[model samples]
Target: MRKWLFWLILPLMVGCQLGAPDQNAPLPILGEFEVVNGDTIYHTIRDFSFINQDSQEVNNQTFAGKAYVVDFFFISCPTICPKVKKQMLRLYERFKDEDKLVLLSHTIDTEHDTIPRLKKFATDLGVGLPQWQFVTGVKDSIYGIANDYFSIAQEDPNAPGGFDHSGRLILVDPQRRVRAFCDGTDPKSVDQFMEDVERLLGEMK
Candidate 1:
């Protein structure tokens, strides 16, 4: 299996063996860890700034005090993107009223997925800023951050839409730590992911 898929599946597999999680217990923080002095440090999302569909700057500050879901895709992907997006739309509807949660999508096809195109994409989905943000930025920056979410985003001339990316939905806590993730193309996976989302929201309270 690929490295990104390993990371994505590891957490979910561990989660399953634990059976029903305690409602009061915090979700386990996923990702690499290291010891600094005597304290253990977990991986965190590197700071990023991108232009959203509304032309507003979106960065870590945009999600302050909120949990966010993240994914990578292009507007024209012909394979799994549409399936992933359908699940994402489920998340949008599920958490649209929650002030403490947000959704962020990064477009890998920066050359074509311009701000106007992103705006149209969101508009067609009946979603908009502050709740769900579709963003574009430097290609390298977008691809680099995909690693942080344990997702993959890259270009391939032979790939559909000239891009290849993982269809993973990542749940990040207020501190920018990855809390949970699921295969975005699977409705059942996303259903469990929603439960994890609610669990994380409870932690924030």
Candidate 2:
């Protein structure tokens, strides 16, 4: 009787695990992680470079071995930028001490947001590089790289900032793969994102 009961309970426990989501599972590799409706093919963030607020050149190498949150915004955006940035600051405060985390804000108004302008904007925000970097580049390069992250940024004659962009904070893993994202314009969503961030970092550990 005891042996029969043990066998029955063992199968039940094994089934539970086989059907359960792995709590420590790394985030899904974004930007084309599959093919043929099943074939696996993970994608990664492509290489690119831009000038940060301090006029330093930044590239994909800057994120080597680190997971960072990225977003697109024009310093002068009159709509979602402010709300998104507010959430970004909250993220910064929460993860600032985590050495593996960083924040990258790319300016979509490339024509007007020069290195100097980016510098001033960083000053206005009361933050600076390494932990948080504000980057600017040629209009086309910035616009193109934004899409590589599965986000959008492009000029629109009718848009508020002269550019239409997504207000999303993208989470990239140490491998350069986009792992997660959240609505930057929503605080509650960011709170949930903060939880995801913790989970992703745990995978790294």
- Residues 1-205 of candidate 2 have per-residue lDDT tens digits of 2334634564353234234335677555555554557876676778889999998989988988999999999988999999998999899888888889999999988878888998988788877778899998888988988876767899998988688999988899988887777778978778767877888899888
Clashes per model (N, Cα, C within 3 A): 0, 0
Clashing pairs in 2: none
Count of clashes in candidate 2: 0
Candidate 2 lowest-lDDT run of ten: 12-21
Report residue 31 deviation for candidate 1 (angstroms). 0.5
* Poorest 10 consecutive residues by lDDT, candidate 1: 11-20
> lDDT of all predictions, in order shown?
0.89, 0.81
C-alpha root-mean-square deviation, candidate 2: 11.0
Q: Check candidate 1 and list the clashing pairs.
A: none
Among the numbered candidates, top lDDT falls to 1
Using Cα atoms with residue i matched to residue i, what is each candidate's TM-score against the true structure? 0.92, 0.84
Tens digits of lDDT, candidate 1, 1-205: 3446666788666457246767677788887787789998888999999999999999999999999999999998899999999999999999999999999999999999999999999999999878999999999999999988877899989988888899989999999998888888888778888999999998888
